[model samples]
Target: MELMGSMSVVEELREHYVAVVGSEPEYHEMRTRSGESVGVFEWPKGTSRMGVHLYASAGATRHGPGAREHAVELFLGVNTGSDAVKEGFANLILSVLKSNTVPQHGVFVAGNWKVIKGRKFTGWVLTERPDDLIPKLQLADGRHVVFLDALPVFPEEASYRRGNRSDELFEIWEESGLKSWDLDRDLPSVIERRSILRWPSWAQRNG
Candidate 1:
C-alpha cells in the first residue's frame, strides 16, 4: 500500500489517479441486460468525491510564443466533509460559484454520466450519436459517478501542485489551504440547479 493515510485526501487522490491513468489499471466495461454496452472505467479505489476547480479560457492567441494557458484545481478527500455535508460538499461550491467567488464563471459543472472507457476524456452527457452507439459511463462498487468534478478539464491545465502559484485564481485555491469552504463558510445548502452545459461542435456533427 502507498501509506495514503499520511497524505491529505486530495493529494492522495491526485497521485493515485495519475498513476492509474499511466499504469494498466483494473479496466472494466459495463453492459445492459440485452447486451448493449453502457459504460466503462479503470475503477481505481478511493476516487475523488469532492473538489474545486477554476477555468478561464482567455484565448490561445492572447498568449505569447511558448506560453501556456493556465487552469487551477483543488480536491477534497472522502472524509473531508462533516455530518450534514458528506458527499454533498461538492454542491456547496456550486452554490457559491456565481453569487460570490468567480462571479462571471456562473455555470456550475455537473456530469450526468462519466465517459469511463473508449473516450480519452469524460463527458457530462454522451455526445449525440445513434442509439446503437456504445454507451459510456463510470461505475464502481455497484455505484455510478454523478457529482461536481473539480479537476482541471485537461492534462495541460494546472492543478494546485504543478500550476502557476502566483496566478490569482490559483492563489485563491491555494490560499484557501484545504477545502475553500472550510476556511470561511461551514458549508452551503445543496443546490441542484441547472447549469448551461457546453459540448464540442464535433459532438453534434455527423460522422
Candidate 2:
C-alpha cells in the first residue's frame, strides 16, 4: 500500500509511463468479466503500437521464489492498432491477477481459446521488452515495477513450451523466424503437435 503524496502507486506509475513512453496514448478503463476495473493505455501505429495494462500492478503483491516483492504490469505489442486487441490483452492481464499467479519472464501461459480474433494465437510468453522498448520503472516507495511483454503464441506452441525449458522454446521461436511481436500476423502455428523429440535440432544447433 504505497502512496506518493496524494497520488497512489497506480497514478504515479501512469505518470512515469507517460514520461517514458510519451503522453499520446489512448487510455481506456476496462471492466473485466469479474467486474474489476483495469486501466489500459494504447499507443497507435505511429507510436509504440502497443497496449499496456497500468493498474494491474497496483496493490497486488506477488509471492513465491524468484517473484518480485511488488506486482507486475503486462503489455502486448501490435503491428496495427485495434480496440479488440487492447480489450483482449486487458482481459488476459486481469485474468492473471484473478488467478493469483505472477507471470514470470520467459514463462508461457496457455489458454484453451484464441487470444484475439482473426489470429490463431492462444497463449502468452511473458518476457521483458527488448532494446529498451519499455524500460522497467521504480516507484518512490522503492518498489521496482516490472513490465512484461505478453507475446502471444498458438495453442500447440504453448503446449510445446510447457513440456520444455523456457529457453528451449525460445530457441524454437528464434529458429522459426516468425515475428513474435506481431499479434495480428496471419501465420500458422510454429509448432503443430507436442513431441518428446522437439529439441533435437535445438540441441544440434547449440552443440
Instruction: Please write out the lDDT profile of model 1 over residues 1-207, one tens digit for every residue.
Output: 210111232233334444533433232222222232211122222342223111111110111233223211222222232322221222223222222222112122323222112122222111112231122222222221112223212111112123322243333444545343232322122212232223322121101
Compute the lDDT for candidate 2: 0.57
Name the TM-score of candidate 2: 0.73
Error of 2 at 144 (Å): 1.1
Best by lDDT: 2
> Candidate 2 on 1-207: residue-level lDDT in tens?
111112365577667667766655665766654456556666665564234322223322333334455667776665664656666676565556556765667777665666665566666778775665667777776667678767777666677565556676677777768676665454345546532221111111110
User: Against the hidden reference, what TM-scores do the models get?
Assistant: 0.21, 0.73
Clash pairs for candidate 1: 39-137
Candidate 2: regions farther than 4 A off:
1-7, 48-68, 184-190, 193-207
